[model samples]
Target chain A: MSFEWPWQYNFPPFFTLQPNVDTRQKQLAAWCSLALSYCRHHKLYTLDVLEAQESPVFNNKKIERKLSMEAIQVVFEELRKKGNLEWLDKNKSRCLVMWRRPEEWGKLIYQWISKNGMVNSVFTLYELINGDDTEGEEFHGLEEWMLLRSLQALQTEGKAEVFSMDDGKGVKFF
Target chain B: MDRFSWSSGLLEINETLVIQQRGVRLYDGDDKAKLDVGAALLSTHRLIWRDVKNHECCLAMPLSQIIYFEEQAAGIGKSAKIIIYLHPTPANKEPGPYQHSKYSYIKLSFKEHGQIEFYRRLTEEMTQKRWESTPVSQPIPTGSATQTGKTRAVGIVGIERKIEERRKETDKNISEAFEDLSKLMVKAKEMVELSRSIANKIKDKQGDITEDETIRFKSYLLSMGIANPVTRETHGSGTHYHLQLAKQLGDMLQAPLEERGGMMALTEVYCLVNRARGMELLSPEDLLNACKMFESLKLPVRMRVFDSGVMVVQLQSHSEEEMIASALDSVTDKGSLTAEEFAKLLGLSVLLSKERLLLAEKMGHLCRDDSVEGLRFYPNLFE
Candidate 1:
């Protein structure tokens, strides 16, 4: 499926940090929302600042305006402040994007599991994520870290449990 | 006052202007008769006192009517005067400013240090009695002035009545000055001063002229009018014209600068200066060129160009350090501020506030936090 871009992606000044306090504030907000929605549309689970700058989300080839690396970091920092992002390392070279929180993902996975009559059923992490039976699901291709976090949320709520077996990581739905 | 008759400032056919003293005031006996700092001209035929701003409020009497005159030495808070005792009003007296009075004498108070010269000339003219020898030449043409023979008198009345009478007089003089362009040019200085005095009187009585700020600001601009703007035709062109223009601009900017928080945009100064000059509009190039001489000419106000290329006219009294210090204070008080917020706090424009904030930042008294949330300034904790 093709990813949809926000209208601000075409604006040239959006790449540059506005000098005016009020204007810059609005620009930052737009950047934050655009960054989040773009990640959500592409199902991007992680982002590198430099790599993101090269992406269509940060660089508009038609307008020839590229969001500076520093500006990208600023947008990421704003997202982190809002709890939608987390730096992968102390150096902030890469970041994990969470357009949907772990708890929200857990709710979706649980709803799917319950609809599929999978209660009390055991399944490997790969089967749960890449399994054919879970195909056509919203979290069908969820990343490992994101899947693990969602499973942990369900485990905390006593709805599901995960175990490391000789074969591989597996989950048992309650 | 009754001994004086309404007269045009024009000289009689055979008469000539002998001496002229500006800043001379007339006294109705001892009371200030609202003669109000006029230009007193001693002609070959008569002594004429005309309001310096209102050319219409002129009074004259034949020098022959002076019984005698003597110099009254200046006292504290009082100008030196020449008290002239006049012969009683003749039964066929020409219509004058007042109908009756108890005092038979009037005083010419010289406020501009010309009492001695005027007194000497008066004595010489009185001894010579030049008009008697010439008989009575035909009265000079009164031009388009309306016949002002309406008998007006100072009545013993309340303060309200006095204010009403003054307003009437002001209205008449203003109308007369507007009779024609040349006539207005001749009387512009008189009108400016007259308005200034009236404004002062209103301010004194009411604490302010009006609740409307635009009206007050307009009146203020009008009151500082350049009565005689240096024109290329009169002062000639080149450096001298610009110098005179610069000087005139300096004189005209003092009050406005004080009122506008010691700084103004060059455009605003141009607007205000042209407004004060009335029809004599100044070109932007000329204004810029004239302002360039402000520093060398040692004017109180100067031209300043911001780093962003905006030109401002500021009073020399407002220093950069003071401006930076004020910006720092506002930032510290507010904890943090944007240019718009700072502008609101200081009653300044966003451009000026931004410049001030940048200045403070340059001084290390403030720090800028520029983010997607927009830029804000905070007092520099490290400094």
Candidate 2:
């Protein structure tokens, strides 16, 4: 699916960090929502500084304007302050982009499980991520780290129980 | 003129007329004197009257001949009159209008203006009684010298005399206008108008007044044209003064502010205000205080101090939003602009232009690009 661009994406000044406090606040808010939607559209769970700069979300060649490394960092910092993003390292070169939180992923999975009458069925992590039965679901392409976090969210709610099997980790839905 | 003796019978050889007033009519008893609508001259020795159109027909009476004098305040549409009570005519009288008169006093009515000031000076000359005392050491060569000069002056000599007389009057007018502030206060209303017209006439015609004095005089009189300025004596030294002053400032600055985009520096206000006040000098503190009252008094203008301590007086209608809009429009019209470039484009000072750009930025209508090249602003597309 193609991601629709915000009108500000083509506006040159939108690529630079505004100097005034009020203007900068509005600019950062616009940037935060744009980054989240772009990530959700492409199912991007993580980002790195170099790769992020190369992303269409930050670089717009049509207008020949791109966010500087420092300005991009400022926008990410704003997103982190709002609790939508997390740094993966001390240097802030890499980050986790949680467009869909673990709780939301857990809710989607539980809805799918109860609808299919598989409330008490047990499933391996790989089956939930890549199984033929889950191929048509929103969580079908979930990464291992994201799958574990979703199951942990379900466990906190007492909707699922995770245990170690001989082959790998598995979750039994309540 | 005919009611009194010929003008020569009035003054001593060395004396000259001290002051002259125009459009005076003399009264003999209750009837108007036949010779009227003339100029009146005040000398230390006598009161002389000369027909304005016919300068040769002049009449004079010595100050010693007057017993006392008083002023008749003017009524509606009536000229101010000065009644001079005289002692009886001496046994030996010169030839003129009447052989004798029934009344002991004669009146001089100011048909146009300034009988009051003339009366005041007349009283002063009478009280001093200079004719009874020593002759003035620096004697003016008047009656006898002029008579001789007229006969001998020819060609270049005649032209020089004409220039000398015109220059003398022009010099006198300049001195009277620039004289002590206290003296100007007493006769300011009428005198300011009189001098401004005369000075302006002299200003336009360079060769009429002597070049040296005219050049020196023009500098001071360039802005000296106002009349009846509010003073401490007129509006007490209280808040009342500031109110009157603020009102006057509002009236005066309205036109100038409109011409200058509805804003001006406080220092410019001081110069413009003081120049319009003419002789009365205004101090900076008083000007600031008066300007401060503009808004409180609901005037059309108000004084403002900036964050960086710059002070300005601007029209009440001038608003921050308007300035920001204008700035944003200009920047967008040109893609982007720096403070200096905008200043040149809008004919505004760089500091004011910068402040306007900053205001636009603060309002989120524009954003700045500050770099090694310089600070420039572009329209805020992020909105």
Candidate 3:
């Protein structure tokens, strides 16, 4: 999918992290926004740091400028601080892109369940993620860890209960 | 050679009498009265009487005529006196019809007995010189002849003769010490004044000297080099000398900085200042330290290191915003600027120009475009 990049994306200096403190802050903010929107448009839930180095979002081939790993990590760190990203591993080699926050995703799932009249029904995690019935949904085939976290958020709100099933994990709406 | 070297307009020798004498009265046969209060200088050919009150009252006399030189003994309530006897007319010249029939003498009475010693030294110098050389004509006793012949010569011819005589007398008295080397020394002092006056004249004439002449004059002044260089010996120690060097560098940089539009690379300033200083050169480290001192002193010039690690000296008043605006003005129709083009416009080295462009990019005044042509800068249209 095509994404409209900001005018600054064409600017070579934008690819190089600015050394000045004030300029760096603005650069970080711009990078964070661009990365978030780029991931959202492509529906990419996880971004591999090493892979992003070669990706068009991090490297602008037209300008022949590429952001270093350190620069990418710094931009990701800013997104993490704003609750828009989470490191999947301790080394921060990969990150879970939270285009929508966990709480927002929990509310989305609740609205979907209520619309389909599935309140008080049980659904296995696998069926909820990849079942044919949920094929058209935004959360279908979502990462299991992110799905589990969203369900846990719903459980904290007393809207659902998660329990172990013989086949796999399952969640039941109250 | 004559007893005195006349190559110098006046007699070359100079000797000061040792005794401090004051308030001695000289009487010339009741017609001339003069005070001899200061030390007398004995030169090779003349006895020069210098007055303490007015140094211009320098009277010289030949050594041969002081025949009866004697110091009278002090008496009760009377000061000691020196008696100098001379021929009624100068012994070497024809006696004129109006010459005095009797002998003539000058008697000087001193206030202190110490002066008697000076008289003795004078007598000794006169006797020693008399034995060494033959007599020469005295140019008519100036005091006595002026008094006697004043009424006879009053016409234009006499006035011209007086001027000629005065010119000759002045030429004989005002010794030129180093006639050949003196012109340069005199010109050095006069050149500064002359340049200032010429500058004023140019100002009055309003562009009469032209830009080329002004530039030539500036180069000429720069070539003159520092007259009094501040070395370690001049300023005492290394640190103090460095501080003084820093000050001198700041002063020297003002002109070049103005010429370059308020900025110059550190290397260029180093070369120029060292050239101006001639023998005294500062090391690069010393120059850096000197620049650091400017911060504490609140000097108007400062040292700046760009992110690219290139250093330059610029005036504190120089604004990056203004530099960007000017650089933008020089951008080609393609809306890009290479370091070479920027350097040419800013009158800086390509390296320094690149550094400044990088700084401007950091400041968000411009954005970089790295292409096959090389790293170029364009105005930050994103802003």
| Runs of candidate 1 exceeding 4 Å displacement | A19-22, B1-383
Q: Candidate 3 lDDT, tens digit per residue, A1-174?
A: 478999879777687666556667777888888998898788799988999999999989897888888889889999999999999899999988988888888898899999999999999999999999889888987888888899999999999999999987999987
Listed per prediction, chain B TM-scores read: 0.44, 0.43, 0.43
The segments of candidate 2 whose C-alpha lies over 4 angstroms from its true place after superposition are: A1-4, A18-25, A41-43, A49-56, A59-73, A90-93, A114-117, B1-198, B202-251, B267-287, B306-310, B319-345, B360-383
For each candidate in turn, the interface RMSD (Å) is 11.0, 2.4, 3.4
DockQ of 1: 0.01
lDDT of 2 at A70: 93
Clashing pairs in 1: A21-B375, A25-B373, A25-B374, B52-B190, B53-B190, B53-B191
lDDT of 3 by residue, B229-289 (tens): 6776778766676788778778778778988888888888878876565555557887887
List lDDT for all candidates, in order.
0.80, 0.81, 0.70
Candidate 2 per-residue lDDT, tens place, B59-120, comes to 77666777888889889988889988877665444445676788888989899888878987
User: Which tens-of-lDDT digit does each residue in A32-135 have in candidate 1?
Assistant: 88888888898899998878989988888896777888888888898899888999999999999999888899999999989889899998899978989989
On lDDT, the stronger of 2 and 3 is: 2
Docking class of 3: incorrect
* Candidate 2, residue B262: how far the Cα is off, in Å: 0.7
